[model samples]
Target chain A: MRNLVVLWMLILSMSIMAQMRDFQVITPELTGTLRLGLIRQNESLWLSDYKKIAAKKNGTETIYTIKHEWLNKGSIRISTKPLLDTHGFVMKIETTDIPASIHLFWAFGGCLGEVINLTGDENSLKPEFCKDNVFSIEGNSFTVYYGTSRKLRILEALVPPDSDVRLSDAHQQQTPLSFFNSGKKNDAPALAALTPLKNNEAVYFCFYKQNPKADYNYFMLPELYKKGSYEVHSETQWMKSTPD
Target chain B: MFKPLLIICFALFVGMYIKAATYNVKDFGAKANGKNIDSPAINAAILEAEKNGGGTIYIPAGEYLCYSIRLKSNITIYLESGATIVAAFPGAGKDEGYDAAEPNPDNPYQDFGHSHWQNSLMWAIGEKNITICGSGLIYGKGLTREESRLPGVGNKAIAFKECHNITLRDISMLRCGHFAVIATGVDNLTITNVRVDTNRDGFDIDCCRNVRITDCSINTPWDDAIVLKSSYGLRYFKDTQNVTISGCYVSGFDNGTAYTAQWETDEPQAPDHGFTVGRIKFGTESSGGFKNIAITNCIFERCRGLALEVVDGGHMEDLVISNITMRDIVNAPIFLRLGARQRSPKSTPIGAMRRININNINVYNADSQYSCIISGIPGHCIEDVSFSNINIYFKGGFTEEDGKRVVPENETVYPEPWMFGTIPASGFYVRHARKILFDNVRFHFAEKDKRPLFIFDDVEKSDISNIRVNGIKVENPFTAH
Candidate 1:
């Protein structure tokens, strides 16, 4: 019994130690460095480029951004925009934290490659792809980063409860199909009013929708943020917290 | 005996061809009286004839006063030469529920109130195939300018709503107070060969469809000489579709601000443009949209704002505006503002303006301000825009040094010298647009502008070709800062 108790404590300590990862974000030049703020589900948080990924927090809202990173660090990429095969989801984010980096990962049903965003936020990134590919995107966050592995930059582990799609992941996600892609619009105005924020009221905004019309899709971004960038203000985040 | 029989038969045939009835205002011992002739008499005559199987209600040569009158199917209200129908005075309703339908009521419109309507001296409701054609005069007693000063309400004129397949031709309407003649939610209507003179809007159309207003001369002071609107009323409405306003001459105190220059109605101080659109938004009262709208071969002279607006209402799609000629405009020669404000608290419809096409537009001698502007929401651009053989000018161009103007003589711009306000955008200004294309565009300035005429705010996937400014190819306006 004594031996078992000691063994359990040792195992617990080992798991905790593994969580203390050497999560350093480095430029390809091995020059710029940034400390990452992370809470991990796995080793998904330790990326090589901080500019390629960023976090934005607005009290209850939190956004995660990942750039359309690919190819060698500091090298131009002619790759397609990031997308998924099962349910192709993409987003773009704009930020300045990245020095130089590109993150690309592969799990494929085919080869359309990833959606690459050259610049800015709020994009419906569509890239030509062939057969099958599985991907996820930050949707509307754009930031600067530098690296060479072109490894995957997963955002789910970083985003808060309600993160908006990044520019790199523009069209929600392409599953076997996308309904709104048909474009047979609605007649009655759906709504897209932007009441200006009074200087004193509040900066953070929130919207909740359930089943959007089959023919229409909507996206909302603050005036100040860049594509693929949650660096300014986190736009939207979905939390799994209890109602209480 | 055979000849006698033939003559009797011929007489019977002639009797069959005679008009069913001939009732005149004079037949009732009615005189012009210079006062508004009660329209009930004429209406009674018309209804009587209809009951007797539909005929003509002749308005002979005389000066007559009149108020609202309705016509049914298969009826003709003919005005002979020298006849005149003077409009009833505007009803006075310091209160909200005053019906413009009845003439003599409490606080009658001698002239005052915005809540009032111009139910046309000769009006009709929800019926079909009616015609009002004549060479006589119809006097719509406009407010005497004193009417505009009334605190809340005041618009005197003739207007119609929800009547269809009607034609109004060869008449002269004078000094209308509100809208000289207004029509809404009606279809298959045509107005031709009419001359309207007024301080109010010459003709106003809203949420109406299949209308044609051609070969008319409209002169007004307030808004569009002939304006089409999609407004938010008691219901969010699409007051227009498939309308053709061609071969007409229009001019206002300023350029018409119909959907083009001004589409937002946040200001509560004024009636907005009689020529403006979307002052109200799409919602509650609405569950549909507007499609296939065209404006071609029209002339807008010295107007305030020109062009169609697919504002922030829910959705305005498939618009084709072309072959437009504008001269001496005060503000923008062409403007498209596509945004809506959900002013109502109800389950108001939202924005969805899409699939638009604007081509073959020409503008000249607009004021020193900007000439053309186009903007869309962030996700949706003013898409597939192609300007072919287009020519626009800002008349007098501003200099970059205008920002540095010495104002050697003391003008505001010259003194402070940071003239940020001197140059207003350009011939083409795209904001938050996607997939836009520009072909064969010519933006001209008075020889001295050193900068390119195209200014893009935030655009993507855009292609430009055959574009010239001051007869020179477009210089790159984008540079690394």
Candidate 2:
């Protein structure tokens, strides 16, 4: 009987560990390396200042929730998961309150060599080699290829239907991402200013390191994180948990 | 002189015999009371008429509660001015309801209401040269508006399948169940001066050909007023061709109010929580196609606008819509979509939409959230569409922020304006189209809106001239590659 009990406990622990492998709590160290904030009334509120409350595992993603008392009377949750068959990650930003704007700034140390706008105007496919410039996208989605030293990073961002998108240098202290440190002049971090989200709305962003030899399917990347798979939990679930 | 006199006498005798073939339900023991089920007596009269090689079945002024009134070919059901046929409720005993819904092996493609013909207040199958006329009322008091498989629940007021040369005129329907009239695979059908104040779809003309629907007043707050569909309910693909709907009035008023002219607004929303859906549309179910259709001189009040959708693996071509005026429009004034729902057999290909011409339209108090959308899927572009002499006034409050929103390529989902939330443009949003033209079009907003008048994405060979916004002339506003 003692041996059988030990085997049962071992099996239960192994199953729990297997389930836990699908989720990873985003630590403070990881959040520090990234710049994220909300832009409201032409002011940038950094995510670093938000109080991290709880981290929960939901399906194939890990949800990290953070709240601000005076922002919009609700919390902001960031759910992220790595791509199953690729070397990238998809992150989604969902809010419980309606903000003036939801912004994301991705800093890549130095200025990108070339910016290739895929879904733009007649000037699409024309390479622009600029360090600190902002490009106005006419549509709600921006799919761009950034060239660096011996590597190409592809990023695709999708906002709510009918919203606009902008790709700008992170060094410029704009209303969207001004709270982040204004790096040196050569730092051209991509900033996407999504339109203000309604309560319980979400925006998705994906980043991938392209393989030089293989053909990259640009259109299929967004389908990896389709909106139907992302579940929006009730605000009461997050409100009931005590702040860490 | 004797032979000529004999021939004249014989002709007079035959004429008099032909004139005496009118069968009356009251003579067949129908009481015409409001309580008793009079369908057996009515059916007996119909049988007597049919036995004499078809004649007129006359129903005079009275209220008759009935169950299923089976219809035969070569018969005319004529009702007098005050005649009303009320649908009776199904009873709990065995074999006590309307005729059991006939088993249809092709029931997979369409809804349950479209698949069955026997479970109705009146039904005709494979019949021809049938006419139902006279100013009378058909009040479906006990039919169900919902789709069900229960033993004793009838859904359609009148259903005809595979019938030809059918005419329904000068009749009124009230509180009809799933559909006021559903005609599938019916050809040479004519409906004129028919009024319907119903709970669900007023008319579903499906898989039909050579149809003429004119001078009708239809009010359906919960569903479509007059919709033309080509569903695969007949187990075969057929086109709804040579159709004309002219001089009709469609509205989304409360049930039983349009006939009374009250126009009540107490029920602001439909059961689906969307705005009231009462408009002329084509094909939520289109397995076959639509061709040579023309709609002219239609008035819409307090309802959604004209929608032309070909989602299910079918082709829509050669349509001309003109002389339309709308007030208190709820959604897009004109929505055209060529989607790839592919709700047919696995061998069917995606559908196509082309060669549509619309002109001389005036709309007032339109919703600002959705623009007049004309969208097609990625590879399948809507081809050769033209709009001329159009004027629309929108209730606009869209800011610059609203214009920046994205529109998803809902390739296979149900097509509706609200499927994509707020459109980026205030006036017109055209995407994935080819060879489009706009001339003498004006857009006026009641309030200030910051979005552009037009937004075109992936469109080719577009021609724009004489376009005005708020009385100010504007050039081609914005185009995305």
- The models' CA-based lDDT, in order, is 0.43, 0.71
Cα RMSD, model 2: 20.0
Per-residue alpha-carbon lDDT of candidate 1 for residues B141-244, written as tens digits (9 for 90 to 100)? 52332222222222444445567787888877766555666665668878888877564567766667898888887755343477665544314345467777
Docking class of 1: incorrect
lDDT: worst 10-residue window of model 1 chain A: A1-10
State the fnat of candidate 1 relative to the true structure.
0.00
B241-297 in candidate 2: lDDT tens per residue? 999999999999966789788888645555444567889999888889999999999
Worst 10 residues of 2 chain B by lDDT: B265-274
